[model samples]
Every structure is written in structure tokens, then in C-alpha cells.
Target chain A: MDKETQPPAASSHPRHHAVPPYLLAAMAACDGAWEAPESMREIISSQPTLDKADGPVSVTRTRIATRARQTMLLDQALLHERSTAHQKLTWLIEPTGRLNRIISDAQGVEITPGTLIRSEGQKPSADIDVNRAYDGLGHVYGFLADLFKRNSLDGSGLVLRGTVHYGEHYDNAFWDGTQMVMGDGDGEIFNSFTSSLSVIAHELGHGLLQYTTNLQYQGQSGALNESIADVFGALVEQFVAGDDAAHASWLIGKGLFTKAVTGVALRSMIEPGTAYNDSILGKDPQPATMAEYVKTTEDNGGVHLNSGIPNRAFALFAKALGGNAWETAGSLWFNVIATRTLPENADFATFAEQTLLQARRDHGAGSAVESALKQAWDTVGVVPRLKENDDE
Target chain B: MSESLRIRVVRSGGVAGISRRGILELPAQEPSGQQDPDWFTMAHQALNQLRSIQEPATAPAVRDAFTWSLNIDGEDHVVPDQLLVGPARTLAEHVITLRGSR
Candidate 1:
């Protein structure tokens, strides 16, 4: 079939997937509902006496209500996932109302409203770090939810879980497959990574990418992925803080470093290399233009280094678009990432093309998209395919 | 030697204010080391003047060192070291020192 003419496939699987009438009725009575056999089994197992003992009608009703609430939460989670996948939006719902039994192993820990764990060595410093992580996550989550109407990172009402003081002097923050882990920075130059809103948002952006494009974290595609996080992270900070392009500092880790450090910031979106200049860490190595781009192995194929190019592109785009960065430029980038069919190894050229396509689709095929696209790529020394006689 | 108190006037936090911390060892008997009321009033005045001079509109016109000031008793004294300047984190330490010293 021709690609343009192909129709969306209708499922041919058995039609035994309808919600039971009783279940539907129960769900309708409540705000919402969901179903997970594993959760039900765990709940039932936890209250095995319910199976053996003849409880009062109220007791049975309470159990049913509890199960229904769990189901509702699961349903919400599913809905959030579907919405995020289809709409490029996130969802946030309180998890306390749900009945999912969380379990953890030695290596992993579950984060929930009630689950509290002490820090290693019972250090007071660890408590501070943990609290900061929690606050930072809450802020970023609220920013995404309030500003974009997103439920969560996955758009599937997923709980935002963060592990604080992860590892010994990890020196970085990262999103594992399931949770966000923050490292306490070395005391000399950096502090707790959780101190900055942008860093939290950046890690969450990684989760967003995983759910959306699942961009491979290597080479140019990796750089694009990293750049996407930085762009959104910076925008999240500005949006939540009510900062505008002119007023925003455009620094990634504006408050993550200690006072002893003489650097400007972790990274600068507007002026790449100018973020910092120090003797120990060397000058900001990021190159704003394509001519000076560094080809290195550090930072996962120079993920951080090459990111400066796209970072500057995003900054320029935001400045030209004016107003809040998240309003137009941010929306454009988010939509492009959501819609682009990116491979794991997609490079800068691929990203540029997809962005151009998205810009045209979003803003019309006019001078605005053309100029923005050209300027962005040209600034990074990536030559785009030219249209014949367009200059005239 | 007459006793003198060394007072450092540190300024931090603005659009792009840096974290600057400096010490001005004053002779304990310096004229500005008078009573607390006179010292505070002078410090307030000096801070106000410094802020006025560092207004966003005229920030570029003022030199970096101009951001710092020393209040002696009831008079303003300018200092040489610009102290801390740059991003938020860089200025955080100066804020700590200023608060701690006072």
C-alpha cells in the first residue's frame, strides 16, 4: 500500500478485552479506575485473612473500595502513558489514593509518599541532600504539570522517584531506567547536584526522551538527546520562575556550584563557552559554532561538548521567537522530538532535517522557518540542503 | 596602638551579581568604629549609595570595584577589591561571609 494511503490498522485480536460491566459500573461511580492482576494479588496476599475469615458486609465493601481505588490509579497510569505517547504531554496524579504495593531489592529502592529511608552513615548532610532532591523533583514535576498540563514524565501518571546521594561522590546526576539518581558533588567545586532546578529537569527530560524518541545516548544522536534535555531544562527553570528570554540567565546549573568556584555556570545556552573560565577545570570547552566543534570521546562521544552547538541554536531560536522560551520554541522542539522517527544513531544532520520539517509543519514553510533553520544550522556549521533560486 | 575594628562591606545578588567576599582590616580605633547605631547608619547609607550606583540602567557605566563600599562610622569609604562577581553560585559564598562577619 502507498504510504500516504495506508490506513491505521484495526486490532484483530480477540474481543475479550472489554471491561467487565460490574467493573465499569464501579469505575463510573468513582472518579476513575484501573486493573493490575499483580497488584490485586499482592493486595489480596497482604490481607489473606480476608479469604479465610467471614468479614462483615462493610469490611467487604471496604476491600472492594480499596481495590477499586487501586484499579482507578492503574487506569490513570495507563491513560497517562497513552496521552504522553500520543500527545507529547505529561500527567501528574497523587499516588496516595492508589493501592499498588511497592517492593524493593537490595540494589533498588522504592520512592512513595510513605516510604522513608535514612541516609548512609546517618549523616545530617545526607538528609539535607535528600530533602533538596525531593524539593527539586517536586518543583520540576509541578512545572511540567502546571505549565504543560502534563501528568508526569511519561505522561502516564508515573511517580517521580529520585534517589539522593547515590554512590560515593558520583559527581553527576543521571536517570536510570526506572529512577532519577543524584550525586553529591565534590565539596570543592560543586555541591549537591539536587540544588539546581535545571539539573532535575534535565534528568527528567532524559526520561521524557526515553518514553518518546528513545534516542540512543552516543555520538551525535546522543548529543542531540543531551541538547534536548538542556534546552527543556533551561526552559523549565525559566517558565516555572516566570523568567523571560531577556531576564533569564540561560545557565544550566546556575546554583549547583559552591562559592569557592570561580565559574559562571555549568553551561550557558546563549553563550556556550562563556559559562565559566577556571584554572583547574580549564576554560569552558564548548564551541558555539560548527568551525570550533570538538570531536572527543569524553562525555559519551562529547555529548556535553557537541551539545553546545544545538544549545546555542535553541537559545537563538528562543530569542528570535521572543516571549517565554517554552511557549513557542520549546513547543516546537518538543513536538519535533515527539514526532520525529529518529534512529538510535541519528546524527546532527538528521536532527536538523527533522527540526526543519517540524518547523515547517508547525510554522508554515515561509521565511520564518527557513531563516531560523538556516541560521541554526549555519551557526553550527551544518549546511542544510538549499532550495534552488530561493536566494533570489 | 589604639584599637580599631576592620569592617568589610560586601555586595551581592542582582541580575548578574557575583559572589564576592573581602576583608578590610581596619585599625580598631578607626573613626567608623564608633557606637553600633552610628556604624549601622553609615553602613546603610554606604550600601544605599552602592546600590544606587549599581542600578541596572547604569550598571555598565560603573566599574566592577564600584560595587564595593566601606562605611566608616557615618561616612562611606570605597574599597579596591571587587570581591566576588559572576553567577549565582559564585556570589553565594560572599553572601555567607557578609552575613557571618556581621
Candidate 2:
């Protein structure tokens, strides 16, 4: 036969092997409803025995093995589908809910949510760390809600989750994208992470930024992220104590260090580099003004170091207003974020401009709030550009 | 077969945001008479592990997490604290704690 006119080979036809209806149903459910044969038997036995007179029940050994194998395959397929669907669901869910909080214990290992020790509305546990985490989360949630009208970090009632006692002598606390992880500290140099309220609030602030501008954590933008978190930390401490800006300590991690260390706290917002000076820790390298803006690649371009510039500016602005920092200053900053005009890689100058615009909108043109904000940015040597640029 | 090995470790970014550095110089191959220190084996193992798993090109910044920069011999490897594990972790801890134990 001519090649052009030749009939198609039988093997070349697309195969349409039929999938079992039961498997299709199981896959559609994808909820692990199909258990192992042994488990199914147990569940069956738990129910009333079907009529015993139904005949000899010819369940041959070979037949049972084949059924068990089929069940195993279905179970595996269901499990895989369940896992995939779970990932998709997690991505789709907006994480909206009430003020829900979950605290777990890592038990001195590098794991998170290791053991669920406490949940919302549960009684306090014997472990003080768990209680502290629970209470701290509550305080932070209250601060955000009462002051900024923010439901939670995401402004959508996202559940606040924390893991305490994360690692042996971990000596640190961090936000690991999904939740907060706190360490017990090495004791020689530092104390328990939960000992400071600012630390807890600061971690949550990162989550807030994640849901907000989602700022790029590098160089100037990274410094803004750290600075905003510190701002939230200080504000929460002040709000809880009912202390005004003047009375507030403006310290980020006070009482976080052991007596063996000479540091009063991790970072001082009002006076950035003055927070610590020790033989072991050296000296805090944060610069309080743009004149001293550090330029480096380490620490995400010295995020913690250069945040001092903005930190001091905020402290100055609050103190200049001379009342509850959370009232005008806090509201001003929160409004800037709520506006959502900030780009992911917004620079210091860009943020300073937004604060100016926000101040003008809230307090009117050339108001005292705007004046203080301008002076604050000027003191830090960050001059907002005359023309507003697109931050999209 | 004796060779000298020098390693420098610079640790930055914790809750404190303090930067610390330490350097260690020890014989790489076992010396003729004296036995190698514990860090000697750890250093070799860390380098081997680094070779096995090359440092990731990009790592998401964890809040208040430490970042370590290691200078072994003359080459440099910057590893985030979250990724520092096994022998590499032990060696980094030892260097930071002892601050050049010889």
C-alpha cells in the first residue's frame, strides 16, 4: 500500500482504559474515606452484625487479598488527591475568622507547631511559656483592633499562631512566614523570648507587612519592614500600659537580655545605637540619621542597622506630638499602610512622602501633624521628593 | 601530609541584631606529634557538607533570623542560619562561642 493511503496501525489508536466508578468517586471525595481493609473490618464489626444466615460467606483467601490490594490502591489515590486538594484550598482560603489563636511547643527542637499545648478559650497550661505566648498574642490582637480597627495582622481576622520553646538555647525569635517561632534563649547572654511583649508584637508586625505592601526585604525596603515592626512593638507596649509617647520606653526588646549582658534592650527607637554596648555584644551599629545610613550586603543590607534612621524619625514624631503615640502618630502610619499605595520596593524617601500625604489628608494641609512629620523626616535627613511618583 | 586550615565566621542578625566574628587556625591534616582538635574534624566536615549541598541562590528572609558568613581558607560562603545544620551548624556554634580557640 502507498504510504500516504496506508491504514493507521491498531496500536497507534489512543487507548481509553476505563477507570473504576468506585475509584472515581473516591478520587472525587479525596478525603481518605476509604480506609485500610483491617480498619474497614473494625468499623464494620463496630456496627451490628449483618444477618448471620446470609450463607457460608464465601470470602476466599485469594479474593480477600485481591480486595485488600484494590482497597490499598484506592486509599493511596485518595490520599494523594487529598494532599493536592488541601494545598489548593490553603491557597484559596482568605484566612478570615474571629480572634482565634493557637499556641504550640517545640520541645527544644527545630520544629514548629510541634505539640498543640493550648488553643483559644482554653485554660492556661502549667507551662509559663505557653501562657505568656497566649496572653501576648491576645494583647497584640487587642492593640491592633482597638487602635487601627484592624481585625488582625491581615485585617481579615487571620488566626494568630505561635510556637514557644522552639529550639535548645536558640537565643532568638522569628516569623517563619506561616507563624511565629520563639526560642528559650541560651540564658548566658539572653533570656526567654516571650519575656518581652515587644518581641511578640514585632513578629506579628512582619505578618502585617506581609499582608500589606509585602515590602521587599532588602536594603532600604527591608529597613522599613524592620522599622515598622519596631514601631508596632513600641506602640503595643505603650497601649497596654496606658502610657503616652513621653512615658513609653520606646524599646523594642527590653528585658530580653540576661544580667550577664550589659544591653538594656535590642533596639532603642528614640536613640537607636544607644540601646546596648557590651564587650561581648560589641555596640549596636544602628545609625539614627540618614547621614549615617549604613551601606552593606550583610543583614539584608543592614536592615536592622539602618532601620534606626526611620525608627528615630517615628520616635521623634510621636514625642513631638506629646500625647498617646497610638492616637495620631500610630493612626497616621497605619493609614499609610491601609492606603496600599506603597510599592513592594518602596525606598525611605517614598515612605516619607506617603506619611506626608497621609498626614495632610488626616490633619489637613499645613497642619501641626504635617509639620511634625516633616520635621521628623528632616531630622533623619530624608527629604521627601517634591513630586509624587507612581509606586505601582 | 600536614596542612594548615583557617576559618572565619561572621554572624549577624538576631533579635539583638548584633554582629559577631571569630577566626580559627588549626592544622588540617593531623600533625606529626599532636592530635587534631575537635574543631579540625568539624571544619573539614562542614566544608564537605557545603560542597555536597551548594548554598541556595536565594533564601526568604526570616524575621530576626541570623545570617552567617563563613570564610574557609580564602573562599567565602554565606549561609542563612535556618539552612545551617549538621556539621556546619556545630562548627559555626563552636567558632562563635569560643571566638578563636586555636
Root-mean-square deviation of every model: 20.0, 18.0
Instruction: Put down candidate 2 lDDT per residue, B1-102, tens digits, no spaces.
Output: 547888888888876677777887776576634644466667778988776766657647467788898887787888888788998888887777766631
- A-chain TM-score per prediction? 0.68, 0.74
Model 1 misplaced regions, further than 4 Å: A2-126, A367-370, A385-392, B1-102
Name every residue pair that clashes in candidate 2: none
lDDT of 2 by residue, A220-264 (tens): 988999999899888988899899999999998999989988889
**Which candidate ranks first by DockQ, i.e. highest?**
2
lDDT of 1 at A78: 46
TM per model? 0.56, 0.77
Candidate 1 lDDT, tens digit per residue, A184-301?
6667777777788888788778777766666766567777877898887898889879998778899988877778767867889889888877755557777898787777543445
